[model samples]
Structure formats: C-alpha cells, structure tokens
Target: MQITQKIPPFLERNLGNVLIIAFLAILYIPILLYWYDGWLNKSINIEHEYFSHALIGFPYATYLIFGKNRHQWQKLPNKNHPLGGFLLALGLAFYITGSAELVAISFPIIITGVMLWLKGMPGLRLNGFPLLLILLATPNSIPYLLTPYTLPLQKFIAAMAGFLLQQLRVNSQVDGIYLYVNNIPVEVAPYCAGLKMLFTSLYVSLLLLHWTGKISDRGRVITLLSGALIISTLANIIRNTLLAVFHGNGQHKAFEILHDGWGGDIYSTGMLIVIIGLNWSLDRFEESSMIISDEKDDNFNE
Candidate 1:
C-alpha cells in the first residue's frame, strides 16, 4: 500500500506572505529598540556621500522578490524545521553580545530563521537573493576596515592623476595624496578613495546579475562583481584626474561643476552605464558559448 502525505493548512494556502510578514514584525520590533540610533546615524552619514545610493536596494529587493518571483512564492511549501529555531537563537545571541552594527547584520539570519521555521528550506532557497539584498540596506560600521585602505587608494588616485597631467604636457608632482600641478595643490581626500562608488557599484552589479538571471553560476557572479569594482575604481580615478586638472588650470568654475551638482551626476551616470553594458555583454557571451557547446555535443553524437 502507498501512503500520501497531507499538506499543512498554512502551507496549502499563502506560503510566502504570512512568513514574510511575521519575519518583518520579528525583525522590526527588536531593531527599533536596539539599532535605531545607529541606523539613524548611518543614514545621516551617507546623505553627503555616494553611499546614499545604497538606499535603493531595499525597494529594489522588494520588487525583485514580490514582482519577479510571485510564482515561486506559490510553489513554496510550509514546513516547520528545527534548523530555524537554532538560527533564531544564534541571531539573538549575536545581537545581545554584539554592537548595533551586528544587530543590523543579524537581520538576514533572523529572517532566514523565520522563513525556515514557517516554510522550511525550499522557501529559504527561493527567497535567498532578496534576503541577501537586505544586507545592503543594513547599517554598516566599516571604518576600521576602510581606514587602512583609504590612504593607499588616495595615494594611487593622486599618482594616476599626476601621470595623466604629465601626459598632457603639464608639470605635476605627487606629494602623498596631494598632487601639485603648476604650483597648485589638490588633495585627494578620503572621500575620494572611491569606497562609496565601490559599494554602490557592487550593489548595482548584484541587482543586474539577478535581473539577468545569471546568478546560477557562482564563478560568473564573482567575475562580474570583480569587474564592476575595477570599473568603478577606474572611473573614479578619471573623475578625480579631471577635477584636479581643472583645479590646476585655475578653472574654478569647471572644478565646481564637476566636483558637485550636475557634473557629478553626469559622471555617476556614465559609470553606471558602463557597468551595465559590460555585464550585458558578458551575459551574451556566456549564452553564445553555451549554445556552441550544445551544438558541438550534437555533432559528436552524430
């Protein structure tokens, strides 16, 4: 005799929504109490920097999960798993012992736990990317890690700008993070280290990777992200060089135009376009390679 398993009442109906709402409530109440101050501070800090662009990840993730994966939600099964309880406990422990940043970071784990507890592994797998996107919205306290890299990046940008100026027949000297052009000083500040651009580019790359449905291969995803980082860094160097050259020439208006306002927007828009183009080109190349491989396999069979 064959036996059939019965679908639980909750799983038979709406699978993703109920768990998602419960997960949100679980995360929000604690976050409001523990991490609110840090969250506010981080928001204020990013307001003046390109890090503000990170805010887009939240709504983008929402649309990606609900809008793009509506069918997957219906297919998800509701099953209570012990692993979920373990993860929830682990997240709470981390929150209690750790700093506010840790609490913010724990959101993904806690939410994952809630999903597992309510719907099990299938649901977690289905919504994994969206959960990861939540990290981008979390407050980060990375100054300790960022500080060491800042000076080197500053020096590198200044050196590259000086080299570019020299190529243009301009007499330039690099003094650490400062470039002296025709006896005019231009400092490459920490904010110019391209960290904000790097973060923003990485998030954008992830979004593109998901939207392109190229997230299946771990290797390709890593390659795309590394390329995005390189592109963003190079773009920032070029922008800095241009600003420095304008400053050196005593073109104060040009410097102001590029350093802020519309000029800055143009620079960022150009970088985003380049990143998107490169990712799209790579995706097409991958698809072509796969098609060629399938053809070769058919020829071998014949």
Candidate 2:
C-alpha cells in the first residue's frame, strides 16, 4: 500500500525536534559505540576498571532524559537563543577536529544549544544535568589531566593506610606511595589515590542536589558538597586500610574481593548511603528550625 503523502499531525508539530534528534543521532551513535567497545575490553583488566563508569553514565543520562522527563520534551518553543547560536557554532567547530575527546565535549555543548534554541533558559535549567553528565562518559583526557595531581592523594592514602595498619598491631611502614604491611609491600597507585571516588561522590552529590531542588540554595549546596568530600575521603582511607590488612595477612581472596569485587561495590553503596543520610539529616534540621520559628511566632501573637 502507498503511504499517505501527508505528514502526521504530531510530526507537523515537532518537525524541528525530529530534525534535531536525527542530527544528534547521526553525530553521537558512532562515538558511543567506540566507547562501549573500549569499556568492554577494559572490563577484564583490574587496572583499567575505572573505564567501566563510561558504561553507566550514558544509560543513566538517557534515563533522566526520557524516563522521568519525557513529557517536558514537547513543550519547547523552537526559536534560537543568541547564546545557543554561539554554542551550536562552537560545538560544530569542535566536531571537525577529528579528536574523540573534542567530539565528546561538543555533544554536551550542542545539546545545551539545542535545548536553548528549542526552549531557552528555562528548558536548559530543567534538563541540563543529563547533558552535562555525558562529559564523564566519553573517552577523554581526564586521566592524563588528573594523573600529575594524583600523586599527593596517593601519598596521603598510603600514609593513612600505614598508620591504620600500625594502630591495628600490624607491622607497617610507609615510604612515599608504598605501604608495607607486615613488610608485604602494597603500592598505592595513582588510580588507588581516591580521586575517582572523590570525583564520583561529588558528581553523585550534585545529582542529589539537583533532584532535591536544592541546587538554588548555595549555602546548603556547598555544605552538602563539603560533607560529600569529607565522607568520600574517609571512606577511601578505610577501604585502602582494609585492603592492605587483607593482603598483608595473606588473605589473597579477601584482598581481591575488596579490591575490585562485591566488597568494593558494597563499600561504595555504604558510602552513598552515608552521603544520602547526611542530606536527609540536614533537611530534617532545617525543617525543625522552621517549625520552631513558627511556634515562636504563634506564641508572640498570643
């Protein structure tokens, strides 16, 4: 049967969105596939396990975009904002560089511009996090950029773990980034420096702030971020100490389990719960103060 020549009413209303979606799909599909292959290959190697975060970032962003917020997509008005025009042009410029990292950066900028061109600032404010989260997903220069600065963190964690081991009556020594627990040398590699944990925890804290609609409260946001940083740092120190203890005592299976297995996952989940709990406690305190103030106002009126 011949198809009708007429465009559907829905398509008629959303032609611009359809075109933009098609263009983005063309631009990003290959980039995503490349990273997916890298993640798959890296998953088998313990040293490169950080690449696995690339696997979840996009899927989670997609969830945020189309799962909870799907209804808002149709409400945008497609008139280009001046800022959006500039951003779109800039993103297009990056797209021609033939560098995967630049191209990944371009995706978020292009998405930002598209959102602005379609619905302006309000739309961006509503849906910006998912696009921004894509920055963490792609293969980029993040590791290279972060490596030089990671030594300090590595040294610090090594020192802390050594101290913990000594406190636990384990013979330990700390020399630079090497920790000797019962003289079984454990190197605190750059990847073990806790920067990834810190970065990941900070990002998750941002997610909580955005979801809770607490992003506007700068004081609370800063407070929450600071708390996340401290919690993640301590958690990393504890994790490393335990791993060293396990390995020092010749508990190879336990060391491997905690190093990159279910033990690590459980530890991470526990850290996440602590961060969430901090947020919850802060909110409860604020609510209690407000209620107390209300009661004081009622007493003054009486």
lDDT of each: 0.77, 0.80
Task: List the candidate 1 regions with Cα displacement exceeding 4 Å.
Answer: 1-43, 47-53, 82-103, 106-109, 286-302
Best by lDDT: 2
Model 1: how far is 231 from its true place, Å? 1.4
lDDT by residue for model 2 over 102-220, one digit each (tens)?
Answer: 88689888888888887788778777778777765545567656878888889998888888888888888999998887789888887788776776678777778877889789998
Clash list (residue pairs), candidate 2: none
Cα displacement (angstroms), candidate 2, residue 234, comes to: 0.5
Off by over 4 Å in 2: 1-5, 33-77, 81-98, 116-126, 136-138
Task: Give each model a TM-score.
Answer: 0.73, 0.83
Residues 1-302, model 1: lDDT tens digits: 99999878877575566666775677566654334443334434442244455456767767866787767766766688999999888887777776766676677778788778867888788788888887665666674357666898899988988888888888788899998878889899887778777877888888888877787879879998999989988988888888888888899999998886578767877898899999988978988999999999999999
Clash list (residue pairs), candidate 1: none
The TM-score measured for candidate 1 stands at 0.73
TM-score of 2: 0.83
